[model samples]
Target: MHAMTLRLSPGDDLRAALDHAFRTHALSAAYVLQGIGSLSVARLRYAGRDDAAELRGDIEILTLAGTLSAQGPHLHMSIADADGRVVGGHVAPGCIVRTTAELVIAHLPGERYTREHDAATGFAELVIRAS
Candidate 1:
């Protein structure tokens, strides 16, 4: 596993910047180690939910983890508002960075990742081939 440290700028958007990083690094797959930062405006959609709810206030990212694929990332995050009210959900499109987000990403071998249809789940999922 190769690790990289990333620093998000004040005006940088979280997912957007990460997407750029993937492209720049030519990464086929990666995972967020953990993220710690603040967000002035956060938009999160928890799994099993149809839509995202907008959060407008000071918030801190508690836990951030996800998978980066060719299709995109399937990220989830837990955040707390100014009052320490915590909420977690599926990462949506509107999670804007406030001050900065310091995070680490680990890249996996490109050939190790493959997709195949699964009858049980009825979807194309990651299938790690044996080395």
Candidate 2:
């Protein structure tokens, strides 16, 4: 496994930046080990919810982790607002960075990661395979 750290600038979309890194690195399989930063806007889908909840403010990213695949990223994060109220859920697009975001990602060599629909879960799920 190869590990790399990424720094995202202000105004960057958190998920989009990670996706870009996955493509830029030409990674077949990778996982976001951790992330820390702040977000001016966050879109998160709470459990059992269909849509995302938009949180806007000086939001601090307490935790972030997930897999990265060609299909997309399956990320989850916990964050705290300026008032210190914490919330966590599925990471969605449009999570704009407030200042900076530092992420460490692990790239697995010779492995392929994909997402396929699973009837059991009724959602697309991670599928790992040898490349």
Candidate 3:
């Protein structure tokens, strides 16, 4: 595994930026080991929910971790609002960075990751393969 750190700037879309990195690096598989930063807006899909809950304000990203695949990123994050209330769920697009987002990503060179539909789960799930 090869590891690297990335810093995202203000107004950048967190999910998009990470996706871009995955493409730019030509990585077949990767995992977000850790992430910390702030966001002006956060779109999170809560457990058992079909849509994302939008949170707008000075938000602190408490945790960020997930896998990156050809289909995109499957990430989960915990964020704290100005009031210090914390909520966590699946990360969604349009999560705009407030100031910065620092991330540690590990690239798995020998493995390939993909998402395929799982009948039992009723959602796409990760599929691993040797590259």
Candidate 4:
């Protein structure tokens, strides 16, 4: 497995940047080791809810870790608002950066991964294709 470090600048979309990096590196399987940064606009899908919630304000990214595939990323994150209130859920696209975000992604070669819609769960769950 190979590793990569990414620093997102202001105005950069958090999820978009990661997606671009994975595509640029042609990574079939990867995991975001750590992500620390801040965001101005956050898009998170709160758990137990079908729709996503938008958190707009200065927020600090607390925890970020998940899987990345050609289909998309299954990332979860927790962010703190101005008052230090923490909100966390499934990460969605459109999380724009406010200042800078430092992230490390580990690429797993010699294997492949994919996501397919599962009838039972009604979601595109992780479907490992290789060991």
Candidate 5:
């Protein structure tokens, strides 16, 4: 596993940035080790919910981690508002950076990743393959 760090500037979309990284690095699969930063706006889908909840304000990114592949990123994040109220859920696009987002990604050069439908889970899931 190879690791790399990414710094996202203000106004950047969190999810979109992850996707762009793979293309830029020519990586087929990677995983987020950890992330911390601030978000001016966050879009998250709470557990068991289908739609995303939009939170706006000075938000502190408490935690961020998940998988990244060509299919897309499957990230989960926790954030806190200025009042210290915390919320977490599936990471979604439109999570705008407030100042900067520092993220570390682990690249798997020997493996490939794809998302395929899983009948049991009723959702597409990660499938790892030999590169």
Candidate 6:
């Protein structure tokens, strides 16, 4: 396994940065080890919602973790607003950084990963390849 650290700058889209890493590194399988930072805008899809809710403000990222693949990342994040109200959900695109975002990703060289629609879950879920 190998690891990488990324620092996102102001105006950088959170999801886009991570997606670029997945493609640029050619990671067959990877996971978001940790993520911390701040954002000016957060696009999050609440539970059982098809669309995302946009929260605009100075938000501090509390938690960010999930699986990553070439197909896309199934990431979840929690952020605290300026008033200290916490909100979190499935991370979507258009999450713009206000200051910086520091992230750690673990790359698994021996594993192959993919996402496929599952009838049971009604969502495209992770499929782990055998080592």
lDDT of 2 by residue, 1-131 (tens): 99999999999999999999999999999999999999999999999999999999899999999999999999999999999999999999999999999999999998999999999999999999999
What digit string (tens of lDDT, one per residue) describes model 4 on residues 6-75? Answer: 9999999888888889899988899999999999999999979988899999999999999999997889
Estimate the lDDT of model 1: 0.81
Q: Mind giving the per-residue lDDT tens digits that candidate 5 earns over 54-115?
A: 99999999999999988999999999999999999999889999999999999999999999
Query: Per-residue lDDT for 9-94 in model 3, tens only?
Result: 99999999999999999999999999999999999999999899999999999999999998999999999999999999999999
Task: Give the CA lDDT, 0 to 100, for residue 88 in model 4.
Answer: 95
lDDT of 6 by residue, 56-75 (tens): 98999999999988788889
Per-prediction TM-score to the true structure, in the order listed? 0.86, 0.99, 0.99, 0.95, 0.98, 0.97
Worst 10 residues of 4 by lDDT: 122-131
Estimate the overall C-alpha local distance difference test score of candidate 3.
0.98
Scored by lDDT, the top model is 3
| Candidate 5 or 1, higher TM-score | 5
lDDT values for all models: 0.81, 0.97, 0.98, 0.91, 0.96, 0.94
Better of 3 and 4 by lDDT: 3
Tens digit per residue, CA lDDT, model 1, 44-99: 88767779999987889999888766656667899999999999998887688889
- Clash total of candidate 1: 1
Candidate 6 contains a number of clashing pairs equal to 0
